[model samples]
Target chain A: MSYRTIDRGAAATPEPVARKIRGLSDRAIAWIFVAPTIFLLLAINIFPLIWTIRLSFTNYKANRINREPEWIGLRNYERILTDSDIWLNMQATAHFLIWTIFFQVLIGFALAWLINKKFKGNDLWTTIIVLPMMLSPAVVGNFWKFLYQPQIGLFNYIIAFFTGKEPSSFEMLGQVNLAPWSIVIVDTWMWTPFVMLICLAGLRSIPDYIYEAAEVDRASKLRQFFTITVPMVLPFLMLAVLFRGIENFKMFDLVVQLTGGGPGSTTELTSINLKREAFEKWRTGYASAYAIILFVTVFGLASIYVKALNKVKER
Target chain B: MAYSKLATASAIAIAATGVAHSAQAEDLTLCWAAWDPANALVELSKEFEAQSGHTMNFEFVPWPNFADRMLNELNSGGQLCDLLIGDSQWIGGGAENGHYVKLNDFFDNEGISMDDFAPATVYAYSTWPKGTPNYYALPAMGDANGWFYRKDWFAREDIQAAYKEATGEDLREPQSQKELLQIAQFFQGREIDGKTVYGAAIFTERGSEGITMGVTSALYPWGFKYENEPGSYDMEGAVNSPEAVEALEFYKTFYETATPPGYTNSYMGESLDAFKSGQVAMAMNWFAFFPGLYADPATGGDKIDFFVNPPQNIAASTLGGQGISVVSYSDKQDAALEYIKWFAQPDVQAKWWALGGYSAHNSVLQDPGFVDSQPFAGDFLEAMDGVQDFWQEPAYAELLLAMQKRVHDFVVADQGTAQEALDKLIEDWNEVFEDEGKL
Candidate 1:
């Protein structure tokens, strides 16, 4: 049959079908297409989040399937809040987060500033500088472990070379005093490149005319840098800080690979402690509560940080 | 008529295929820690495969991640592992959580007697309530902490004379913990073969159970006990007795004075490396690794010798090894059980030993020439006789982690006194038991 004949015959038939087809709006059709994605998000992300929050209120163990979870009201949260070890973990995490970000921002901005100056083999130097961040954090953690070894590690030997101390005189990851700094050093080494790249972008985005205008106005090199360069780059620097802050707050794999959170809980971040509770100890409810606390802390801090960044940008 | 004939032929063909499939070999996945014995088990499992008409698939995770991976699989009800040779401490958790198939009825029906296994292995690996008849697993590998030393270094005439002159005693195998410490101290920074060598590399690993495993050898010999009574969570005095404090102090002293530089987190692998590299004169490690150590061309061949962990007030060694269990979540329990049955035979166990896997079977361990079979065989038997284990409660991980942190802080970090560390450990363990409603 001809296509026209088939279409005419179909049109002549079923008034109910034609009305049904015409009744659906463009917005309704769009909802039909987007429904699956929304359902998936609810299933995988939202559902688990709600379930975890619910579980935080109970005495539940994921491993003990034989026992039904008992609702213990705010017991888990109360215990966590009162727990000294959790506070110690928080202290360790804070030490790590503060020191790592400080070093990364300082060294990263310096490197970016230097590289932004047109220099010989600048592209090659940039690639080399970015290499550590490009590698797997697990791989970097493992190799850095070897490098931190006191007996044969190149790191100790290099330090010894300059300081006139014995190569095996100090233990990096072994001593309580050195372990936290050791993790900080490694994190700075690996992630500083990321901050450098962001700063480099920020540096490059400043229009040449701004610097030229400053030069014509007889502004000193340092004054121009502070007034024009840094102020303009503040938003991007804040963005870098925000990203690193969130990432380091939940840091697990690298620290785990490097030290497994310890010569003693000295380097145990909150994430590492939570993992020990949730998976190793099988304390599901306690871990969930701990996770929620961490979530709230991160969320509250980031919100404040973003608002501050927005204010700075408005200036 | 033709359609009917075709249908009949197809039905017969389908039945024939089903029968063929049933007769074909089944594939069984056995999960274990990736260690020397695991490799040995892989070689030994071939015999089972050939005899039982089943193909063996192995999932071997490294020691650090093994418990995490396997427990996750069990908790998630994943059927990834049909048979799991899990750590001894997992018996309580597995049994209570129904992760492992209860093997009592199966053992009775299959005529597989638990009595055939070594008593300590059965106690550590199979039972949950210490001495109960409840069976969840079959003891597969037997291990206990033992010492390996450089026999050649001790045999040197100059070193022997110097050691005797300095200590006023003959240089020999340590008969007591005091002597062990002296030997370790004597060898520390001692020049051997024109190279400076350090002392014994004991387990100081901070992460998992390394320090606890190492320190307990000293603890048990120095009169440390977990409780005043079995099944009681009462750890107040027993875990922190005066002798236990002394033991902890001694362990810390040894770690500081004897071990090589940066030996902060050394476990079996690190100890082996230190020994093989000639960086240390002696080391403490599990019996399971002894065979591999003895076979190493660089460090073996009259240069190395094995000894039991020395006595103090009492002689004891830390128990190490695992039991094999069928995962309850697995669909192929029958096949897995058949594999176990084949593995349980005396000959197979003997072959397992010959392939370097520690066979916990009494028949294998009790062989007339078993002690004479390998260089470390006698030491293994002696150590196994005095083996002590950590708590086997369902909350063992919590207890272990607390001990790890406490002991590590005191021993490695030098953060607190031994008494304080043990007291803190007691508090932590009591808290865990309270949470479990056992206190």
Candidate 2:
């Protein structure tokens, strides 16, 4: 009778057991497929992340490797959090983010909409407009620096032509107020096309039948655009925002080449400050802590943004 | 047939031994910044290799990432470089961190005393924080900061005559900050060399070392000190003194009126470019660039001239240069030390001067033969005499960054009054000192 009860229970639960056995094999296969990828991810990303976190708790100067690292828990974090300069750098980064996002989205959406309309040489115009995105940021920053030159630059020359007086003799990168905005302008020029490309894909993916049906319903072009075009492209727009946000958040090379966080700390982003702390100052522990803080901040923002993007997509 | 096979095997063994000997031949690797001085050092190294029977491998890195690259190499415990040429400011950290092999015994054995070098050059960049801290590096490039001008323009009889007529005083070399500013004002917006030239050019960029070096050269002589108090490592009152504020105000005036309007972003490279292009009548520069400016025809090689940094209440110039040191991690420490000994020989130093190396040996620099050989030797030695070495501390890089930021804010941002900027710098510098437990 006990044996019979056991058999009955086994039969009833066989679905989950069989499913679990099948799931185990499936998991094995899945792991087998992803083993190389996992190895790569660990090698390229997770290992470094763990090492950086470990270094954040120890005093590790790059120049002094042989010396035993001392555990200085929470000191680096304390320094960064309490430091006014770090906070100022954070403000600078925030300023860059707000201005860059506003300009990139507004300008990008408009360009995408205009290009979606079948105009003459639409393909050629679109290609030319998108070219800046393909160019390296360093290359673009360098050329724009040349353009802002007061004496021999084309930008000044054109300004001089319009005004009867010689162009306003302001040094764009030299002025503290202007330097941050200069970076914003250049970033916008280079990346608006990227946003536009995504929006364009979204626009093209919207079925033409929707527009046809709206026209049959006697909806005005403005009404149709608001009801269909915007709604359809919103998800793609969020995706573009997510990408550009992450990228611009970690900007280093271009700023280093262009203004070098200069004209004062006006253009010194958080990443640049962190670099100065770590490599230049050789305060490894402090820099690592700064990195962790930045990672957490960016990760949190990105997570929230990604969820929003998913919601938009679902709708 | 067995005897024949044995003979063949012996012959093959002998050939393999020969190959092994070849593989063991002496090879030395050297690394440095890929700047003009580094180029000169490379040229000198070829001569050394030819004479010493050692094959040399050269590694030249760009200036921007140079420190990080050298640090990585040193910390890796890899035999990347046998002989490393590095900035003098790195000496303290290098010594404290055991990145460089101590050279006191080596110097003594070689009979190459530090006293032979310009006293100012030897101490500023080559010495560690503690006076007796192992003496890790040999003073190699005893470079200093100084002023460069166009001799042709300065000696212009018509301009001098006009200035003399107006002021009833002979227009001559600048001897003080007051005179330098006056000279700048005299030449502001003047047409020269077929273009409108500015009076002066100096670096003012943020986060760069150039601005701090240039600005502090003026400020220090005017009673500004980066240390908090004499004989104290505390860095509070020194940076934001009344004298420093006055000096900065004077600097601002020159930048606003006499300098090229775009002076705020200028660095060594840009300042040199401006001078070479004849956009500026004078510039403050690293003395290392003197040879290159003299060699390059684009800058009127024969016409360019220089002066020791002028005094305000006292004479001063920013100390800048490189030191030659053996890698502490080297497997061939003895061989590296041997190289430094040979490098310090009087005859070798003379050759170094001939090949454009800034000889730290006073005997070579002050040699009548050397002076006669190079027309600019006198000025170079004069500038060397005036140089004050960088502030030596284990946390020097951080100290410099703090100063650079504040100096940038003062000159470029105009974010606060000069006093306010200097006060902030003092506070920041003190914070660093406090963190390091020196204050």
Q: What is the TM-score of chain A alone in each candidate?
A: 0.92, 0.88
Best by lDDT: 1
The models' CA-based lDDT, in order, is 0.92, 0.80
Identify the CAPRI category of the predicted complex in candidate 2.
Answer: acceptable
Candidate 2 residue pairs in backbone clash: none
lDDT of 1 by residue, A1-315 (tens): 699998998789799977876799989878989999999999998999899999999989988888899999999999999998899999999999999999999999999999999989999999999999989989999999999999899999999999999989999998889999999999999999999999999999999999899999999999999999999988989999999999999999999988888887889899999999998889999899989999899989999999999999999
Off by over 4 Å in 1: A1-34, B1-24
DockQ of each: 0.59, 0.49
What TM-score against the true fold does each predicted structure earn? Answer: 0.94, 0.89
Q: Which residues of candidate 2, in runs, are more than 4 Å off?
A: A1-26, A32-60, A66-73, A163-165, B1-24, B161-169, B228-231, B369-373
What is the per-residue lDDT of model 2 for residues B257-344, given as tens digits with 9 covering 90 to 100? 7788666777788888888888887888877777888887876566787788889988877777888899977786666776787787
Task: Tell me each candidate's RMSD, in Å, in order.
Answer: 5.2, 6.5
Considering summed lDDT, which 10 consecutive residues are worst modelled in model 1 chain B? B17-26
